[model samples]
Target: MALSVVMPLDISGESAKYPALFEKMGVDFTARRCTTPEEVVVLARDADAIITEGSQCPIPREVIENLNRCRIIAGTQIGYDTFDILAAAERGILVTNVPGYCVEEVSDHAMALILACARQVVALNEAAKRGEWGFGPHSSHIREVIRARMDALGGKTLGILGFGAIGRSLAPKARAFRMRVLASDPFVDAPVGQEAGVEMVDWPTLLRESDFISIHAALTPETRHVFDENAFASLKPTCCLVNT
Candidate 1:
């Protein structure tokens, strides 16, 4: 019997990206878009493996309990919060995700957001469009207000929560701007941050000392709502936060 691989999401358009590889491995592949848990359970009943987009649809415990032969559940994205890993593991199903796939792109995006906030790019652009050029007397007050809110990246501290691939990638970029980088990740050792030219600090220290905080942690029981009202209160009043 041929090995069966089923996609419970609509990836027909992306089939060409992997069909030849699956064929080379002598595996049977099927792509079907499933909108509901019942649809996923029915379509994946006999699948040896299930490929999922993960973000659009969730593979709940109920769906996992009903799968007859699925040995593995693979997600296309780094975060797999949409899937019930505990339930899948109880059923002897392996769960996997693609990490570091868009590390550079995401890191760059984080930096862009940080710069935009630091420079007050959006507000300044809008002010310009409103004919409030800084040369005018009234515009001078606007300039002062904007300038009061903006700060240079140099000599500032950047805190990264979760020193994973994207966070590591972002550290060097922040350093390039002459900012001090602090990282907090209980799962990672201190040397990892030291090697990346970042200081490994506790969550509270990172929150209180940082001029900006970037969140790159995965969503899990321990991490979910880690940044709550209390967390926000710990931040410097001038601190900017960018979530990716």
Candidate 2:
């Protein structure tokens, strides 16, 4: 008999190609979308593999305990915080996630946010829409505000919170704009940062020196709300933050 797969999420339009792809691989599987835990328990009772998107549903202890023949639980997100790993492991089920799936896209989005904050793009566009031309003597206030906020990217320092795939991808992009990059990741080695042309620094050093900071760290007890009141008080008043 072929393997049975159950998708416990509403991935209709997004996963239109999954059926064809699995068929091409000669895997005869039945993919069913279960929106709730009760539905999942019913549909996946005889399933061999369970697939889910991290946002829609969480694979809780109850769900794991009820799976009859599940061997694997796969997530389409980088983080598996939604899944109960211990429960799955106890049931002899492997948990998997795709970490490097959106490295470039995420890095690009972070860079775009940094650029938007630096240039005050939204404020300027709104001013233009309100019939305010930032030119001549009458617009001195606008020009002064722009001059006070806008700074060139070259020679600026960019600090990254995590030195993972997305952070590594962003370092080179920052360097391309003639900006210095610093990273702080307890899990990564100094050599990794050096190879990516980023200097490994302490969290305080990165916060104090960087003109812009990009956060790429996962949400954990240690990293959750790392930029608290004390951290904000240490930053430069002109610094911009981009959290992805």
Candidate 3:
């Protein structure tokens, strides 16, 4: 009655954990990169526990319907829209994910992206490499690159799409920079974000007033491609967009 766990992506801790707890529990959870529908179906149907990555390998309705043993699924990261939780629940299955895993690392990543875009890190680094400093744009395509560096995060609004762990972590960073934080997360109450010094604003206000829009939403049927053409059209042309 060993629990077999299958992974869609590489789990960070393996050599240390495997053959230790798993071996002791009689659970031989072999983590493998999911490759095909057949492989997914076979592993998922047989597994008592499953750990998935992103939306790439969808645990389909057939898999859920036919699976006889699967009872628990733990996604490796925050987004579990790939797995059919409703179906899992219908079958009395417990589906879980790591919501705030590496919160600081993610916050640091978002800030790095934001700052890189703001400071034109690439363009300037290239300029310095070529024995050029405070250099102007080389072409019309890049004429606006330097302007990105001069822009201030202060006196501007930072709009976060989803107020999950990453969003919560970003608030203090934005506050440190003297920027006002506005976030939208239908699932999270306004007070939750407000406690972190972020004012929860509606989508329209976030779009209109924000100088920087950061996407932290979980991808779903509703949210997939949410940042498509029309959304971009709605954004202020000068607004910088960062995603994590």
**Can you give the TM-score per candidate against the true fold?**
0.89, 0.87, 0.85
lDDT of 1 by residue, 30-136 (tens): 87788999998888888899988788778999999998888999988899999999999999999999996799999999999999999998888888888886668
CA lDDT, every prediction?
0.90, 0.86, 0.76
Identify the leading candidate in terms of lDDT. Answer: 1
Off by over 4 Å in 1: 12-16, 19-26, 137-141
Show the colliding residue pairs in model 2.
Answer: none
Superposition error at 170 for model 1 (Å): 0.9
lDDT of 3 by residue, 1-244 (tens): 6678666555566433654777787787776667776777766677787767656566756667777888887766777887788888999888888887788888888878777766688777776676556435544324555554557677878899988888889889988989889998889887788689899988878888888888888887877887778778888887899987
| Rank ordering of all candidates by lDDT, starting from the highest | 1, 2, 3
Decreasing TM-score order of the candidates = 1, 2, 3
**Clashing pairs in model 1, backbone N/Cα/C closer than 3 A:** none
Query: Tens-digit lDDT track for model 2 on 55-138?
Result: 687788888899888999989888887888999999999999999978999999998888888778877777777666668655
Number of colliding residue pairs in model 2: 0
C-alpha lDDT (0 to 100) for residue 7 of candidate 2: 79
Better of 2 and 3 by TM-score: 2
